[model samples]
Target: MENTIFSLIPPFLAIIMVVLTRRVLLSLGVGIVSASLLLANFSLTGTVSIIYDAVKGIFVSEGSLNTSNIYILLFLIILGIITSFITISGGSRAFGEWAITRVKSRVGAQIVTIFLGIIIFIDDYFNALAVGQISRPITDRQKVSRAKLAYLIDSTSAPICVVSPVSSWGASIIALIGTILATHNITEYSAFSAFIQIVPMNLYVWATLAMVFIVALRNIEIGPMKIHERRAVKEGLVSDPNKPAVDKLQEDLPTSKKGSVGDLVWPIIALIVGVVGTMFWTGIVGSEGNVSLLAVFENTDVNTSLIIGGLLGLAVTIGFFIRQVLVYKSVDKSVFKKGVWAGTKSMLPAVYILLFAWTIADLIGRLETGKYLAGVVEIINLNHSFLPLILFVIACVMAFSTGTSWGSFGILLPIAGDIAAATDISLLLPALAAVLAGAVFGDHCSPISDTTILSATGAGCNLIDHVMTQLPYAVISALIACFGFLVIGFTGSTTLALLTIVVLLILFVIITSRRTKEV
Candidate 1:
């Protein structure tokens, strides 16, 4: 069966279903079954076979057994364990009690959340759960909307990870770049050099971060976000208290009498230190004396390194809990195993959604959705000036439809790379950079995105509310990024273009601030 534009029906159908019914799981299920039907040539029996095969592959064979999946599973379990242990030890409660005093205003609480997000930049998952556990209670007390808290949490998660070179996200990106470059036999640029070059060109990421700060700092709310904020302020409703919260682990573990700031602070610090240190050790041992940080990332097995680091962090949490029980006699030693089990159970929903989302993404690839999209560019004779902008838009639309940034990167990077190879080789970095930026932008808006799910879970917000409230801000930042990209496309100067984005971002803040006052 030939893959055509019709291959795109599944994702669109999924998005529409989610919009109409607000049922993410059902929407995704429909997407998978419908897409399977298409792949099976519309035979009902064939669709059943396709579904069974996909389930087996994801759970029984390739998907679960793959190195990347193993690492992620291990990391998730350890993360669950660490968060549960710390929360049960009363660290989360103590931190909230301590933070509430200093963070008296909503702006103060948001700034604290932003800083907490930046400080824990090793992995987006770590940042999402840790920041959410620690910040939600404080934000709630300050009457900040769950949507607003979710927006801050979501923005910082993937965007922060993407920018930081020492992160798991960076490792995946570098590996992808290396694989594509090797496969294409392109020697004009080294992966390391190219990745470094691509960072500055990633406009959507930096712009999104800037938007988060501006929104938090100046108290600018528009669209659905405005309604939420106004409701929070006027009615004293921070979020839907009735909604099922993602912070169940925080409650299930049960707080202890020996609550203190040290309980929360040390465990998080240990996790950071353990992950970074282990990553370095793994890289050094693998590199055989290649000490450059990026070299270690390039040489190191990312899955193995993260799992080891997560284990070390888990060990630290266990040790802290045991000592707390012995010293303070205020903690329960019994909660340890049950807490870990409960935490692991909580992540199953997220895990299933991730697997299904991956399945949809795979189907999209087999169907050549990106190729169909890339063909649009192939026909047009775009010059250098319009090329980056066009590539950015394609990447955005493709990524938005698919609801996965890395998947979009996997599909679009190679095509964009090919386009660059055929045209001016200088377009290589910019083209790749454009894909990275636009993918993150689109993922920001996607309800089914794994990062978005984690963000909602971490912040204890309704997922639909998070998606609705954050979309406007994401669009504004993306529009600004598009403008900056156009400036770069025309002038071929990254500095000037970046400056233009910053200037526009500042102007947007000022204008919105004045508008809010007037209203």
Candidate 2:
């Protein structure tokens, strides 16, 4: 019943198993069962009881299946519905067509790809698949390598989502941070506060995003990316065999209406406005009209606001879909129901995955894994200045191995928060930021990451080629992030750290460029 070194085994073992088998669900199940066994003191009956208790805890427990988490789940469901509506209505195809006509050059094509990648800030999987599928044709016509496009899609997908405040990634991050804080009985802080504060410290995400634009705007390439670009331009070979051609995920039904760009644009804008507005509205309402906007944000429930936004977006999408159907008469009325049902069905699996993640994370807490890991940190007694970089590296390694940033977050954040609180509370945001940034960095380059695979699939390139070509660029951004974290860890000045990273990246790009290819 006491916290011990063994408490850490389940998380680490799960990570190892994930790395070896590339099986997230199995790995997570194994972790939960293993922890349950240990908590049962290795008794089979006791372990079963533990599992039962955990299941009960998720739904019946007071806080585990509470309002906040429920809303978060609802938000995801609505998000899926919106995405399905977009695809089945032919909104995606219409937008892609509209976008390509304005692209007068290769740079313009790549820029549009990057722009689309950045703005798609919903889910990483969606971002990758959408950007890659939509932009690939334009890139191919412009002679840009599928590898480059994959890199663009892969890099932008996670990086943008992880930073976007209204995204699924943001919800996951908030939920994780909040759960950890609650477990620690740290009521003085808010997850939203931490989420907002940590943004500046998330150097890897910023660096990765910046690197994509740098690559796009500067017309340069490095390492294998350079060679791939050369091959594409000179040989007119766009696809790379190293990349696996993953079949496009089928929509509920083909669209007959041929949706306009406005169809895609309007829903997303409504979603964004809804999310932002509801956040403030909830914040103000929670504070009883006696707090600043920041205070309200730090006090309001993000899960509720996000759910509201998602629902609002869904309503807007439904309205638009009906209007289009009335005007164009393109698709049958039955198509709408099928699209909604399909979207809802697609998200159920993901929602279940999140629940499983929550269960395992709870198991870790029950096992006192955080205290065990924090004890080890205390034993090392490393300088607080080194903690950010150390935590960043650890997070990156965990995420890279598991190919699941969410898992890495669930495992590391509570422990990191524990270590920081027990050592110096000031390091809390930095530690969280480090873990978030590192997890994203690892997920970006990980061969097994869903986003990475989807990027390759969407671009119709070999998966391995995307991985290999993107590696150098990912490493460069990571290295820069590492240095920036180190500086910020020591000085506590994000401005200086960001400035240093900017200079370093500019120099690297300028020094590394041989001759810019037309592609």
- The prediction achieving the highest TM-score against the true structure is 1
Deviation (Å) of 171 in candidate 2: 14
| Candidate 1 lDDT, 1-519, residue by residue in tens | 335789789889988898888777788899988888889899999888887777666545643566666576667667767777877788778887888888899999999899888887866766876687678878977889988999999898888887777776787788788877887788878877778888999998889888888889889888989888988999988776665544345344667867788877787777667667776777778775647776676565655766777787788777778877888777667777788887787666666667777677667666677667767776788676787888889888877887878877877888787888788777777888898888888887887787787788778677778888999999998999999889887877899889999999989978887887798
Clashes of 1: 0
Check candidate 1 and list the clashing pairs.
none
Give the top-scoring candidate (lDDT). 1
lDDT score of residue 41 within candidate 2? 91
- Per residue, candidate 2 scores C-alpha lDDT tens digits across 50-126 of 88888677666664456765775676677767777776677766775776677767788898898998887755755
- Off by more than 4 A, model 2: 1-5, 63-65, 103-202, 215-252, 381-388, 391-476, 485-500, 503-519
In Å, residue 165's CA in model 2 sits off its true spot by 10
Could you report the Cα RMSD, in angstroms, for every candidate shown?
3.1, 6.7
TM-score (C-alpha) between model 2 and the true structure: 0.68
Root mean square deviation (Cα) for candidate 2: 6.7
lDDT, model 1, position 215: 89
In Å, residue 195's CA in model 2 sits off its true spot by 11
